[model samples]
Target: MDYHTIRPHPDLSSIVKCYWTLEVPYQNDAQRQLIVPDGCIEMIFILGDDVKRFTSGDEYIIQPRDMVLGQITEPFYVLPSGDVKSFAVRFYPYGFSNFVSISIGDLVNKETPLVSLFGNEVATALADKIRSAADTLERIELVDAFLLERLITKPTVDGIVKRTIDAIFSTKGKVSINTIVNDDSSKRRQLERKFLKEVGVSPKQLGKMIRLQSALKMLLNNHTGSLTEIAYESDYYNQAHFIKDFREFTGTTPKAFLGDEGMILSSVFYKQD
Candidate 1:
């Protein structure tokens, strides 16, 4: 299992975290990888076999070549086909809204095909350019160009959604529904409706997802840190509580997770909040 991460270009730095490429050589039957829940959205370019995304008790097939994955609101798992080789550009929760007219909330509950949202030809071209690129940096540039072009066509974030997103980031995903609501709960309801339509998930769900994403980053990048320490730092009540939440999202224990090379191949794909 090998993984490489490349930073996004300056023009896109605020929206895109980085482009991540993974290569896994088959040795034998490997355990299915448990990809914990996270907040950010991704545009995955499959260079080899297909990838399976399991969420909310359902399985969605991500065919080899190209696709865009929206913000994951619920816990999910993924398993690579016989041999794994893929690359993806990870986008910040707020950054994605800039490229599409829809709200960040709409991307939550599912994975929509990039072709449907961005058009088949455009999606295919972007994926091909990235897969054919000689280096990670070049791939980043190509993705940046793709986003820049879309930004011209998409609607900018409205004041209400902008304010709501600001609150989420400020609270580090701990923002309550009450906080986002106006004096009346009507705002909350409207937000929920809009969020589901544009972002694909509720504001509360995205907050939890973002919070979990932070925890995963620390655990994967700061390997020396203990799970208990990570849990506390990530704002979970305690180690036991954290493990329960983690397992609920990932379908496996954290310690066992580190031992699986295939699991590590995917976990490293998440971009820290």
Candidate 2:
């Protein structure tokens, strides 16, 4: 398996997080890999064979070659049908909304084909260009151009929503919504509504997701301490609290997460800076 990421263009640095690519050889006895929420949205282009996302026990659906994966609240599993080659754009929590008119909430926990979001003609053309591009650099150039065109006419993100997300990141998801709104009930309601539309999750959920990512990095990087210490470092109140949130987002305990074969893909992702 080979995985890596590249920084986005300067003009798009704020909204676009980074571009990433992955390649893995086909294994005869490949296990289904578990993927957890990471508080980001992604635009993905599958360049090699198909991949399957399990919808339920022993049942699955093939993912589109080109699609947008929204903010997932829980863990899911996917298995490549054969050798895997994919290119994707990872957007900030509030970043993807700046380019589309559809409610971001509508995209949660599922893969929506690019044609569904961007019209068939436009999406098909872009997918063709991405597929035919000579290499990763060329694909990045094409995607940047495509996004830049849409971004020019789109309105700026809502101030309340952006600020809330900023606070979440700055505090590593430890900041409460009440603190953000200064205990104002009306303002809290408004923020909740805005978050549902713009971020596809409540402020608290996003915060927890961000906090979980921090704890995941520590665990994956072999932080020298007990799980309780790691949890405290991640801003959780205690070990039990940390385990609850960890299980909520990842569907596994922290100790179980490490050395779990199903976590190979997620480990590669969180291990990155």
TM-score of each: 0.77, 0.98
- Tens digit of per-residue lDDT, candidate 2, span 97-166: 9888888999999999999999999999999999999999999999999999988854488898899999
User: Candidate 2, which segments miss by more than 4 Å at Cα?
Assistant: 153-155
lDDT of 1 at 171: 71
lDDT minimum window of 10 residues, candidate 2: 149-158
Task: Give all candidates' CA lDDT scores.
Answer: 0.69, 0.92
Clashing pairs in 2: none
Q: What lDDT does model 2 reach?
A: 0.92
Q: Which residue pairs in model 1 clash with each other?
A: 104-199, 105-199, 105-200, 106-198, 106-199, 106-200, 107-199, 107-200, 108-199, 109-200
lDDT of 1 by residue, 53-124 (tens): 654455565553576677653456677666778778887655676776655555554667777778888887
Q: Pick the candidate with the highest lDDT.
A: 2
Best by TM-score: 2
